[model samples]
Target: MLVAVLATALLVGCSPRSEPAPEVDVTGGAGEEPSLEYTPPLTISEATSEVLWEGTGPELEDSGPVLLDYRLQRADDGSLVEETYSTVPKPFTLTPEVLSADLHEALDGRTVGSRLLLLLPATSDTSSFASVMVVDVRPTRAWGEPVEPREGLPAVTLAEDGEPLIETPQGDPPRSLVVQALLRGDGDQVVEGSTVTVQYTGVRWSDGSMYDSSWVQGGPESFDLGSGVLPGLAEGLLEQTVGSQVMLVIPPESGGAVGGEEDTLVLVVDILATSAPAPDALTEEG
Candidate 1:
């Protein structure tokens, strides 16, 4: 369903018409799914978007990953088409190659946590339909209050673009797992079995050499905390909030071997977004 909508939305060249953009009454607080009130059979001369509410977080200045929660409705009848508010928010890169020109313009210069209303006109293509979209911008990196790390751990610093730089400590790695929050976000808490989107860098405690990185992979990656992950990495992410950055020190027994080495693993993870399992899935698991 979303694929079809995106296909039509990304296409260029809408047939020009005389009708003005409809006045949509969007009613919803921040972090809630919006309720849109607009008359049916809406028409617009061109594709346009309006910022309903602005955000206070970091301003987008580059082509990077953006987390979004949005809803699409048929402009002709306001019929429900698809939405991401009830599930996990989707990720998209902020680039002209990845998004339509109109969408890229609407999202550019906007800060995280903004809500936008977009009016797209029908194209000449027979498969196209006019759409009214409401979008909520979620943070793609950790954005929150900073926290002080405890003493005697590997120090962490940030680059100009927010990537973590790790300096290895001199002593032996801790025998047990260590989970420390560096940036405390206010978003949803990660539960026991949630899927999370994150940007992370993993380094070895022995020589401070990087073993893995999501940032080096071009963008963030999603992980299901319940399976197919290092036991200590998954355990450390639990209870962390969205938009937070955390440091996890995993012992050899918990982190297992990394790159065929049995050394301790040090990971700095930026918790971008998290989606808890649905009730039915949890019931099945139980």
Candidate 2:
């Protein structure tokens, strides 16, 4: 839900509109360096796509956390416009706005580890440009490694689909915020200001009313922890290692934000990944 992520926690989700993957031609297959070559049609008037290579991994579901390495080129001449080959594959949550309608139609039901090429027909609208995107889908974490459920505080359980089932603990809510790490990762520690990608769920401490859930949305969400976020979230997330799942019980907001200011908030944050450290303005004068 793009519902005030600063005031509310950001989660991922997709709409009910989706169709089966389309069949198309791709130049390369899995286990090889990915590549795609699309010959522009002589009578191009519509967008079209083909699967350059098929992945043997799981078929993508409607709501997704798909990773892709894509190269964009002009549809008219196939001239390179941009690419992600130098860097790592990027993550694309299967949300309604993740891509343009034409591209979304191309990606529906594509498998993890598949490669695809999308060819766009010249646009009648002046606001957009026609282009081709060569995409290499990669496998990403479906779920964090399971850890023993911690007792005390609210008990957290997982559904068959990996969505968190929070059982708010009985007792007077903590006067101060609480942070507890459930699972740990060997990846980079979450530094202050690092763009952190995570899956999370938030609920009101009063009646256990869920306010947000990434699992429900579709996949994981990324946020800059260093930005002016909630005191409870910044405190709970800063310096925590990536791949760690932490629980936070906040004692109501004292100032600006979404959600109830009097209602104590509870959050289960899973630090799935981190990237793009905030640029340093602290450099000494050269």
The candidate that wins on lDDT is 1
lDDT of every model, 2 decimals: 0.82, 0.61
Write down the TM-score of every candidate.
0.89, 0.62
Backbone clashes in model 2, listed as residue pairs = 12-217, 12-218, 13-217, 24-50, 26-52
Determine the backbone clash count of candidate 2: 5
Predicted candidate 1 versus true structure: per-residue lDDT over 1-286, tens digit per residue = 5545666674553333356667889998998999989998887557778899999878876588777789888888999888987667777777766666667778889998899888887778523678888999887678879999998899999987788999975697889999999999888899977888888998999999898987776667777886789999999999999979999999989964777779888999999888877787699889
For model 2, the stretches where C-alpha displacement exceeds 4 angstroms are 1-58, 63-71, 75-98, 112-115, 119-130, 136-142, 175-177, 215-220, 252-260, 280-286
Clash count per candidate: 0, 5
lDDT by residue (187-224, candidate 2, tens digit) is 56766556767778888777888878877776766667
Lowest lDDT sum, 10 consecutive residues, model 2, at: 2-11
Identify the candidate with maximal TM-score: 1
